[model samples]
Target: MNTQDAAIPSLDSDLADGAITPIDRPTLHSVVVSRLRDMIIEGVLLPGTRINEGQLGQQLGVSRTPLREALKVLAMEGLVELVPGRGAMVCVLTAKDVRDMLEVLSSLEHLAGTLTCQNASDAQIGAVRTLHDEMLAFYRSGDRLQYFKKNQQIHSALIVLAGNASLAMVHDILQSKMRRIRYLGDQNDDTWSGAVADHEEMIAALEARDGPRLSAALVDHLTRTWDRVKDAI
Candidate 1:
């Protein structure tokens, strides 16, 4: 192997039974849990896909101990379902589950937006606007991945602006559940332009400090987005 090639683990070597280097982070449990969670959300591990503990634990380079604990966390998050003696698999959302989750998410976001409108300082609004502008430029550049990353920033900023710690915590949890479904929905739905427009309107409402208007806009935006993807579920 060349110097560079020798520096990196060979694909075959890394896939070996004992190839996983031990993680040194103190919070290894959460890291393992988060990696598995992202794989599930990104559809790398499809919904209803049976999780092979041995394969997964090996692939992730951890002992089965941490992998099992990670699966347990996912089960609590509703991303994975535990089957007695059968092990865990990604949770499949029925149409009803999708509908219920969408409704709950929309309502909660509406509440958050309303509270943000009431409580956000001018500086917070300015920050969101800056992020929105950056998003617009990134979208114009046709960089969906970059835009998606910034899209996350904008949402998190809004939640922080809400000035409610509990609501922010709730949003983080809900966003994890919605991530996979939202990706599928966004992929099939052609209403991204409308969605962006709605976001602009949301900004306007916030700028105006109109609590009621922001709340209504959030609900309408989430509902419309959900409707577009509901049929696919």
Candidate 2:
């Protein structure tokens, strides 16, 4: 077996061991989509790299049908590009694409900050604070991947707090596109410190329920983040 294929856990074995339950069809599709999305975002599958359907299917321990379906979903999300006669490749973002996406993301986060401050329950805000603390711990420990994941969770929580389903859906799509670039931005020590400071301001604004301040902070944060990552993109 190939290295990638060998690395995959057997689904049947996992199921038999009660490690993974037999999910419904739709849920299984979602799982496949999530796995492929993560693989791309984490750089396991590099940008512009052509996808090998057979090898990937073996690596993921999924059949060809579900893998193809998952690739379609990823294509719709702009994480994969389907080229005629060339099959699918991971999407490569141009500098302009990054700029455009960050602009939209900044606006969305601004709205999220405004609505979250106005609408989020005390419990929800507290939960976000807890997550922020956990993220900080990851940062302090120098666990970049874990820190990035928790950072993502905090942003997602803010969207959830905004209580707008449409906003949440749009934000998720854009966020997926920017994940890898943002992760790379944090690799610089100065930029990473600045991001942590920005998060601190975000938490403070949330705690004070200052909608306008939080909105401004979110916009400024995203702008500076783009500044840090633009050259790399």
Candidate 3:
């Protein structure tokens, strides 16, 4: 071997036996998508408003390419409509639309609750507990955005813990589309407190591994969610 080649260390052992876990960091495109999702959910980008790509690109400090890509992602998530020549527009969900999706979601979550209570490992339940604690902290601090994010995470975790990939896939699609409407469900102090209380019951049921109780809690929560947001719609 050449002298320089001999001096260089081999990575064969490290490649085969490395113990370091890979970090899962969000990509720039995903970050942009998340910001746009938050804006829509919080009503900053009102429904039916045309997305000004250039303006948003500048505001977000990203070039048009990534911004457009992010918009395409949002379109797929049903949060935006892509018009032929008019660009993207924020999607408007009618009361019927919200009701229909929530009904379906309630059913899906009902199944998930029972399955999760039966199937989730202790560590999986602990992970959800951690998310719940963080969500409570955000609620206490009056950080609505962070609280909502954690709230969504907890629901997603429940579906995931059920161990049904097909159910999870369908649930995710509906959940993504309903995010903006769902965010409005707890807009006031009274409704917010009610929603938080509902979550407390859910967590208690989950920790106790009571499938029937968790299923009932999930259904009740989604049913009340309609009442909370229907007036706004």
Worst 10 residues of 2 by lDDT: 20-29
Q: What is the lDDT of residue 230 in candidate 1?
A: 78
Which residues of candidate 3, in runs, are more than 4 Å off?
A: 1-15
Model 1 C-alpha lDDT per residue in residues 1-233, reported as the tens digit of each score: 68998788776777685777767765889999878876876689998899999998889899999999989888877789999989998989887777887788787788888889888889889989998999888767766555656776777778878888988888777776666776554453256566678788888988999988988888887788676677666
Task: Give one digit per residue, the lDDT tens place, for model 3 in 44-136.
Answer: 999999999999889989999988998999999999999999999999999999999999999999999999999999999999999999999
21-56 per-residue lDDT for model 2 (tens digits):
655566778999988987887789999999999999
What TM-score does candidate 1 reach?
Answer: 0.73
For all candidates in order, the CA lDDT equals 0.80, 0.91, 0.93
Compute each candidate's TM-score over C-alphas.
0.73, 0.80, 0.92
How well does model 1 score by local distance difference test?
A: 0.80
Name the candidate that leads on TM-score: 3
RMSD of each: 10.9, 10.5, 3.9
True-vs-predicted CA distance for residue 124, candidate 3, Å: 0.4
Q: In candidate 1, what residue range of length 10 has the lowest lDDT sum? A: 183-192
